[model samples]
Target: MGDHAPDGEPPPPEVEPAGRVITTDGLTKDYGAVLALDSLDIVVGEGVTGLVGANGAGKSTLIKILLGLLAPTRGRATVLGLDIAQHGEAIRRQVGYMPEHECLPPDVSASDFVNHLAQMSGLPRAAARERTADVLRHVGLAEERYRPMGGYSTGMKQRAKLAQALVHDPRLVFLDEPTNGLDPAARDDMLELVQRIGHDFGIAVLVTSHLLGELERVSDHVVILDSGRLLRSSATTEFLDSTGTLLIEVVGETGTQDRMGQALAAAGLPCWPQGHLIAVDTTRATTDRDVHDVIRDTACDLGVGLARLQADHRRIEDVFREGGDHVLPTS
Candidate 1:
């Protein structure tokens, strides 16, 4: 069970009395020679959960099946507890979708497009326009909402796409690579907006992305897929163990790192230089006293101020590296 909540906080108990916003049992999809989804089983509830994998890892296949856009070759799935195979029209009414590829019409203004979508979702014309405007402003696209999307930057285009998805006030949203092609600052802004959508608005979000590191920062639970199979699924924090390694940052000349490495080794510590920093790899059995002694004497002998020494946070990439799955080779 993937029980970890976002940012180390406990998730609220399921609001739906029946529980499980989404579930799939033995869900399978095939493309001739390739099995896109191999009898995959999954469960998702309220709040934000990340679906992550490299391209062609069946992330897209799973989303398409869940959205009822593609029928599974075998097995079955339910969205909001309604069988997608039989209740696809009903499911689409409550589920908002932001597809991965670009689908916006270049000639239309975002305000017009979003308004049109809102109305299509069963809102009255007046209410659709109002909600469209609200959603555009919420996604930081107020200034450009009226402008034709063909001239808009990639970031602006993305915001326009997002505004359309939220215009319908969907109970659950499927966001596909919401940060795709964004610069660092824009990507951060998009992530914060995603978190806000799930937490502040109380909407269930199932977002998919290829960037493992960014997903780790925002998702409460992370599900990893490999070669169309479930490689691992668990709470994000659990994926990162509290390894007792201390990442020490010392400021000095070029040889300072080398000197510190030499000094720590000579002092009977199995320390090594890592890029511009030094890392003390403590074993599971190593005590706090062992780290303290290593840090204290090593800094004093090298005459380098401690600068900073804190427990190293294991990154999501580290887990994938250890899992021994290879990435698809590019042609």
Candidate 2:
């Protein structure tokens, strides 16, 4: 049973929640100067942490090194309080990994596959059988668990992989691109299952994805990587807070937006056009009330309707842009 501790199944009365599920010290990886990970130091606590980046951003490299599938050129790391270099096997026993690509054998049923892996993880035969059933149901594959892997849809294949990852009752899980190759509805379903694994099942999750916005709905904290380096690491709430840029749209005649932009610039508040809205830079301004009054008076003087006025917030993609790393918006 994946007794989501949050669901009235709190940790044992004798045990306190542990801290720092993962930590890295100067973690660096160099494939003959490519430098996949560059002096990266980070600590991951409980709950869902989103690792976001585009292709070649060292996300996969970092996960592989942490899982002991690959070694770093220099630096040390730990997972679940076990040193990766010395206790790689022990770490693997406590952590689960759902790889990004297809690895399921076509002939075997998902039930057989999960049960076999559960046994491989040291579960007793009967316990393995029981756990396999529990996890498959947990991942929404209970009804389809008997089907051959080759006959499953892309969404079902993803769920089966997730079921195997959870069959062993791991303390943490690494979900690499779990929503990949899914349509909109299937993608939403997969993301919800991932959130349940972390939130409902009480499993620490490190989910990596190129789709930025998807994580905002589920992740507790977000860590951004770009070009093999850390861009930003903070709570999801902080990233969604007001960015101090006011998005205002003035409606009137044809040249109203441009005229408002010019008027705001003349008033010493730097402004620019963003499609249909004018982005007013408020960093140099005194206060929100003052800025609001100024904009309101400017619109009144210009005889235009204040269509929209609200503070802007940074998106996951904005983190990269702010860090001077230009990339296409994946959301």
Candidate 3:
């Protein structure tokens, strides 16, 4: 059944929203002496943008402020062009949120819960039921949609949460760690669904996660936060670009790589361990020590044969390197 007016007329068709999905200017939140979010100024456009940080790094706080569930101490923000402080209810009506914590009822069936939420969002009972069944099937929960959620596994529970968020056909969604407890295969499946929501359905998405490398795959843009402050913000390809570093792999005894890295470091070559290979900075060479010369000498002194030497591309982990030059993306 389709949504209809009380006068027996069909409801107005949904319109696709345009412009920036979210924007904040000097958004900050604090609890007494502790600061949770610090002066966050960012603009998120369409597609998937990953809000990445550690557990206590204000990722959740930022989302709450944007959703108008929590107030910011000293800044302004807008969601879909409406001021959060003034149009909170209106904003919530057009946005779907999947929280990080478990909030599902033990005895409620997935079908019932999603259908009820759809009705609450202003759909008629018949329309809500039809929408719920479709959304549940889209999330891969069609076979077990009627089972009580308390008996579902972690992956199944996650699918149920996703089903509810999409039942209302919101223009935007905020998914807080949708892959938190899922296995590798489940996580991949969920990420694929997230991509489909953004690209196929044309819904703006802001997904949060603690893993930088994992999000880099699905996120169009990545905004990294550290200690409640903006660390770096850029497109996904910027993170994977080449850093002008040479990867040196060696063939030797048991601890050859570690010993080689230490020796290179002592020779004033900026080198670090990347898995079993040593990554040396080609740009950080000093006048006294020729970086390439030192590496050759070190390998000869240690009696380790240099197996490979080639330019290495930057990895997401380099974002945390102590002296890395993390350049934010230009608009």
Report the CA-based lDDT of candidate 3 relative to the real structure.
Answer: 0.85
Output candidate 2 Cα RMSD: 6.6
Best-fitting candidate, measured by TM-score? 1
For model 3, residues 1-331, the per-residue Cα lDDT tens digits are: 2333334333333322555888889989997777988998888889999998887889988999989999899999888877787667777888899989888998999999999999999899898999999999999999998899999999999999988888899889999999989999999999999999988988889998888777877889999987689888888878778777999999988899999988887887788888888998878865386667788989999899999988776766665664365332211
Would you list the C-alpha lDDT of every candidate in the order shown? 0.81, 0.86, 0.85
**Candidate 3 residue spans exceeding 4 A from truth:** 1-18, 244-312, 322-331
Of the two candidates 2 and 3, the one with more favorable TM-score, higher being better, is: 2
Ranked candidates (TM-score, high to low): 1, 2, 3
What would you estimate as the lDDT of candidate 2? 0.86
TM-score attained by model 1: 0.80
lDDT of 2 by residue, 1-331 (tens): 2222223332322212376799899999999969899999988989999998888899989999999999999999888877777666767877899998899999999999999999888888999999999988888899988989999999999999888888888999999989989999988888898888888989999999987788877899988887888877889988788888999988888998999999888877888999999998899764455888899989999888998999998876676567574563566
Report residue 113 deviation for candidate 2 (angstroms). 0.3
What TM-score goes with each of the models?
A: 0.80, 0.75, 0.73
Q: What value does the lDDT take at residue 239 in candidate 1?
A: 76
TM-score of 2: 0.75
Please state the error at residue 165 of candidate 2 in Å.
Answer: 0.7
- Indicate whether candidate 1 or candidate 3 has the larger lDDT: 3
Locate the minimum summed-lDDT window of 10 residues in model 1.
1-10
For model 2 the local lDDT of residue 216 reads 76
